[model samples]
Target chain A: MELIAERGYRRTSLAAVAERAGLTQQGLLHHFPTKELLLVAVLEARDRWDLASSAASAAGSWRTGTLAQLVDYNATRPGIVQTYTVLSADSVTEDHPARAFFESRFRAVREAMAAVLRAEFGETLPGGLTPERAAPLLVAVMDGLQLQWLLDPQDVDMPAAFRDFVALLGRGGD
Target chain B: MELIAERGYRRTSLAAVAERAGLTQQGLLHHFPTKELLLVAVLEARDRWDLASSAASAAGSWRTGTLAQLVDYNATRPGIVQTYTVLSADSVTEDHPARAFFESRFRAVREAMAAVLRAEFGETLPGGLTPERAAPLLVAVMDGLQLQWLLDPQDVDMPAAFRDFVALLGRGGD
Candidate 1:
């Protein structure tokens, strides 16, 4: 991931990745057959890490707690967000290997978010404010915030903005 | 721009751009000394087109009317939005030329939006929400909406979402 971040994915090769991992190319290939597979593994690892960290942060009362923690977590790991942004942009092309990976990842992430929202709000949300409807909005906000943050990290108050947005959701605004 | 869109920017060249534009390579070089300069021109052209369209659409009423028009205009230009997204992602590197282009574009767009918002609500907005603060939120929402639209265009009701979000701002939701 660091290599890809420093030098783009197209320039980073499997051998370089293996070298970075302190393993022979053959040994790395035994675990992951192709560079695409390795990229997927890297993405999955990041996703799992995010979920685990979010879950741990929400251990007690995520439902009632402020959403600032989640926003702060994202702020700390801009690299993961940048990777997804870069890969997702590339994946928009029909033949990009990571296209399917991002599609599935997006679906899974949205589902998990919707589930969390459903659990939190229960039946109080307004009509048509179902998890499915809200999930896209939430994800969109995150993605948009990341873009702005990348452009001008100093200008974007990620946690504050997210907290306000979440509070508006809680209030059933609009 | 078409060449870069068709063939990824990294793969495209000044000669191709000149060929596409029906100009000599020296002529193109006279205008843009480097590939990065050409890309910046393309990005600026895109920004200018979007701004012009947005201004035309938003020329009438300052409140709901203009907001709706802006959303409508954005909905009609998915390609332009995608171009911006792709370029912005690529411009994350410090040395990327599109970085400065986007930074300036973002500032200019936000200023235009802030002027619109200020014209709409003036000093009477609920909670006295300044256009500066509201502008960033509105831009964030728009940026976020584009991502969702790219992923699943059918799933997002762009006009309705923007309308509702703006309406909420008119209230004290900000």
Candidate 2:
């Protein structure tokens, strides 16, 4: 994660990842035969942090505080966050190794986000938007803020911006 | 522009770009002494389209229709859109060639967006959020949607999603 965070996926080598992991190349190959497989593992490991937060939401704790906490946690771990941000955007390219991984992950993410939103706001959110429609925009804002914050951390304030967006989402019915 | 659009900055070579433009390496080098200089030129060239739209906003014509039209136009030009999406995200890495370019561009883009939003909605928008606070979110949504759309063009309708967001932006006043 650190290697890819600094150099990006295209420049990072498998041998380097293995060295960082304290495993021989052959040993690494035994568990994951290809670089794409390694990339998926790295992504899943990173996403596990978010999935745990979502699970907390499912258990009724992932509100504004939890969301803000997640953002703050991410801010402290710039290396992991940077790896995820750079790779996800890079996945947009044709023939990128992580393209399919991100595509399916996004499909599931949008669905999960919609489900959570539906639970919170009923079938439709405030301002007459169905949870389905609002889910992608929510996802977009989070992803988008990450890009800006990563580029200009001093000005972006990822946590505060997200809180404001959530406030916006919950507005308009009053 | 087309070269970097297809291969990304690191993967693209100066020689290939020169060949594509019917210029000798010497001629290209005279114009842009380094690859990073060429990259800035390509990025600036691409940004001219957006700058023109922002200019229109300054002239009082860049509202929902123009915003949607810009997204629709970008949808038709995947190569150029892909170049911007990939490179901008890639710029977050340490010592990346386009880091300064994107950092400053985002500052300017955010400031410009804030000015336009303030003009349309006043100092504080309907939800009691300031235009300065709202501008980064708007930029994030646009950029974030582009990333998702490029990855899964069939599943994600970039322009339509942006249109939904614009409508959402206008909704709270009612």
Candidate 3:
């Protein structure tokens, strides 16, 4: 994952992954037959890790606060986040192996965010924005902030910026 | 630019660029001594295109309105935007050739955005958010929205979401 994060999907060869994991190419192939399968396993592992961490942090519930916690958590683990950022952007192109995974992941994220907004703010948020309307904005800010923060950590305060956004959403609603 | 946008920086070769542009490799190298130089020129050309288009549409100025217009304009030119998206993400790697260029570009962008916010809102925006603070968010949303829109244009209304963000910034400030 660290190798993939630093080098990106196209550059991170199976040999590198095997080397990183202290396995021969043949040894690695014992567990995963192809690079695509290995990539899928890596992604699934990331999802599992995120879910486990979220569940632990939020006492088995993931809400807006938990989401904020996740952002804070991401700030501490730049490598994992970088892996995600790089892969997600790479997946935007047609025929990329990770395209469908990202597509479904984003759909799930938007829906999860909308559910959280609905729970926290009832139906409408400040300035008459629906949960559905605000959900994409929420996801956009999170991902967008990650890009800036990654590029210039000294300039972009990921956690504080996220907090400011949460405050905005928590402000006066119609 | 279209090829780079599709295949990203690492995969794009000078030969491919030469073929795409109907020039020999030597002919291309006459203008850009190296691939790195060519990449820089491409980025600069993109900035020029954006500035020229923004100036024409916004009457020789760039405000939040112009920024929104740029987003609308970007939707119409997915190739350039995708090139930007892919390259920007790839550039996040510490050793990427475009890293310094992106860093400086972001710094200038943040400063420009700060000036714009300060001009429009006079020092502070709603919720006491300084222009310095809000500038990153503005830039983040623009870039972030591009990612989401690129992934699923049918679902993500990039312009409308941007307008909503501008509205958020405009509301209830000192």
Best by TM-score: 3
lDDT, candidate 2, equals: 0.79
Interface RMSD of each: 3.4, 2.4, 2.5
DockQ metric for all predictions:
0.38, 0.58, 0.49
Candidate lDDT scores, in order, read 0.68, 0.79, 0.81
Q: Number of the top candidate by lDDT?
A: 3
Q: Kindly indicate the candidate among 2 and 3 with the higher TM-score.
A: 3
In order of lDDT, best first, we have: 3, 2, 1
Model 1: how large is the Cα RMSD against the reference? Answer: 4.0
Off by over 4 Å in 2: A1-16, A30-37, A53-65, A172-174, B2-13, B33-37, B53-61, B172-174
TM-score to native of every candidate shown: 0.79, 0.87, 0.88
Report the C-alpha lDDT of model 3 over A87-107, residue by residue, as the tens digit. 778777667777788788888
Model 3: CA > 4 A from native: A1-13, A20-22, A30-40, A55-60, B1-13, B20-22, B33-37, B56-61
Give Cα distance to truth, residue B153, candidate 1, Å. 2.6
RMSD of candidates 1 onward, in order: 4.0, 3.1, 3.1
Q: Share of real interface contacts recovered by each model?
A: 0.37, 0.67, 0.45
Model 1 CA deviation exceeding 4 Å by range: A1-16, A25-39, A55-67, A122-128, B1-16, B33-36, B53-67, B122-130, B172-174
lDDT minimum window of 10 residues, candidate 3 chain A: A53-62
Clashing pairs in 2: none
